[model samples]
Target chain A: MTSKWFLKSTGTAAALSSLVLFLYANLRQPTLTEQMLPVHLKIFELDRTPQAHEQQAVLAVLKQQLGVTAVSFSQEGKTFSVTYCPDKITAEKLRAAASLNEAFKVSEKTFPPSPACPVPPLDEVKHKVLGVLRIF
Target chain B: MRKFVLYFVLALAVGMSLTACNDDKVLYEIDPNSLYSRLGGFDAISAVTDQFLANVAADNVINARFAATVANPARLQLLRNNLVDQICEAAGGPCRYKGLNMRAAHTGMNITEQEFNALVADLVAALNRFNVPEKEKNELLGILGPMKPDIVGR
Candidate 1:
């Protein structure tokens, strides 16, 4: 009788622990890997930065072909910066696409490094650590 | 303990892989149907504007209005930039028109209705030169139409 009770108790504990772990893992938000992953950026220059229409066209082509994340234009400087995932698209492909020039003069220009993600909140980190401890 | 560690490792790998896959899958998507997209974005705008400016330069009546620009390369470049910004902003493209307001800019110029009509014709010719779709062309002209009061005879 005692042995049966011990076995039952052990099974219940195991089941409860499993449930806790499953819930914790499944319910938790996945941490973003954007910080670790490298972002690729390329700049294109025109005789002058083309108008919005030309920018939009070039942006569309890049987004379709290269899966670019963002594009920023400096009209005064006549330049544009395209951000993308290097894993999905190559800078060369972006250059070739931007060179189409259906609207304005577009030639590839060098850009500065990609902007960094802001630091993660310390409170969020502490909460996550505490949650992990509770699981143990 | 060993089993828990193994399970945790497996879960971590699964979670990371799932996140990574989703990350790249939705990295970026451009709406294919936006006016800006249809007009071929900045490149197309630039091409059209360059051609339009060339046409404007050749038009005797309106060319005089732009005489100061023709005489100065820097002023012409600035004018080109402002024109592009204005058109793009009007067409709901992602550009901010930073030039002087139309009423202010044309206030003393006393631009006539004929000159205004001529400018529009030149614009239509430029749009046609680039083969901009009729729908988009008409939509662009409609957007520019409202500015006539602000631009004409000012």
Candidate 2:
């Protein structure tokens, strides 16, 4: 009987704690980014040195993508960067589109491949978590 | 009766005050050859704003200051809209700048004089890229120059 009472007390405390947390999360004011969907820049390494035509083609592919805002190749033409709305398109989608051509294969099998500075995936996680926590 | 005369006088006074308020709402008179017109109106202003943003992105001196803004598309677009509106309104165009004043916007940023000058230089470069005339460019710069005090070293 004593064990049962202890279990009940712990359960009650846990429920109350959850209620407080839920209220707090739902009540706080939304941040500036929370009000609008955020944009991200994804850079990809090209498989081979890009020719002028290949550079233009890659830019065209990314630019024609739904949420892409800006696309530019690196000075060396070995990598390119795309600024896009993640809510509308993903780096994977961009990789697929850019690799459709036989000549230029993008090394983006891993959504964010290595060889450049990363913006930290933690920001993406936080953006997604905020989206889930937001009640209204 | 005396009451009728008093009511009539009160109505006349109230009518006059309302007319005065209406005068304040009259449309602003813009000169026929205003800078806004010379700059080719809204489209030209928008083009210049886009070029300026590109220039700022490429500028190393001031690019770091705007990294966060460029990272967020919404914020970037807001900055673009505010810039276009500010320039339009300053040039006596049919636009109203509803954003925060220069001091308020740059208060916590602690912008340096060099950074501020770099920004102006970027804008000037953009105007030059568009081949804006010397007279028109100087006129626009003259209009925006006064905000330097409010924006720099704050």
Candidate 3:
């Protein structure tokens, strides 16, 4: 009788714990107010090393004109990387606004592959399951 | 023997619950048309960008920061295009941004929260010029609002 009671009590506890966890995980969902911020990065290739004045000139236009968030140049690589809000700028416009010399070449790159979109809120699925179970 | 039987039943219940939780994971569908289309597509976005830039240029607080582009028409146009593309991509349009991240971009600018707020006001004005509804404007701002930490106090 003791073993039977032990089995019954433990099984009840296990079932109860599982139900709580399932409800918590499945019901949680992000509210409408929570939105994701997006940023973009672009690189430019220069035919030759840009002079100090040239670099300054480009930086000024990028900052003042393009409203870029951050701009960096690599003297060693003869290239520059700029980070900006994509909502305000694109790689093409950044290259154009810089007004580089004829020798400079521009290439646009896409953002790296992000993981898949989040699964829908589990609460919706839970409701559907409960509804189906009711049909039995 | 009965103890083993109880353990097996408890374990089975736990396993089933775990499976149910996994099965319940659902991907919420987003309304793809909402942001992109409501903003009036590419042309309207471009027009809004133009207005926003003009507001930025006129605002004395942030105008000095934009002096480089304002002096030259070519540079000004490029800036406008950049702004439009940025907004478009952010709104889930076809355009892609290949620029730096916010923190890396705004690091040395010494931008204050006031300046950032001023910029946002200008953007709202631009959105208003085109009569972008309040809901859409709020949504757009919501998307950009998180960038404040990276942009301000740097």
Point out the worst 10-residue segment of candidate 1 chain A by lDDT: A111-120
* DockQ, each predicted model: 0.02, 0.03, 0.04
Candidate 3's C-alpha runs over 4 A off are A1-136, B1-32, B72-78
Binned by DockQ into CAPRI classes (incorrect, acceptable, medium, high), candidate 1 is incorrect
lDDT comparison, 1 vs 2, better candidate: 2
Order the candidates by DockQ, highest first — what do you get?
3, 2, 1
Q: Which residue runs of candidate 2 sit more than 4 Å off their true CA positions?
A: A1-136, B1-30
- Best model number under lDDT: 2
For B58-117, candidate 3 gives per-residue lDDT tens digits of 455565565544433334433454466567778877555433567765676788788898
Position A113, candidate 1: lDDT:
33
- Candidate 1 wrongly placed segments (more than 4 Å): A1-136, B1-31
iRMS per model in Å: 18.2, 15.5, 17.2
Q: Model 2: per-residue lDDT, tens digit, B1-154? A: 6854664555555434433432111266766699988998777887687667756654556655666665555456556656777898898876667467887777766788898888898888879878999999999999999999988877
Best by TM-score: 2
Worst 10 residues of 1 chain B by lDDT: B19-28
lDDT of 3 at A64: 72
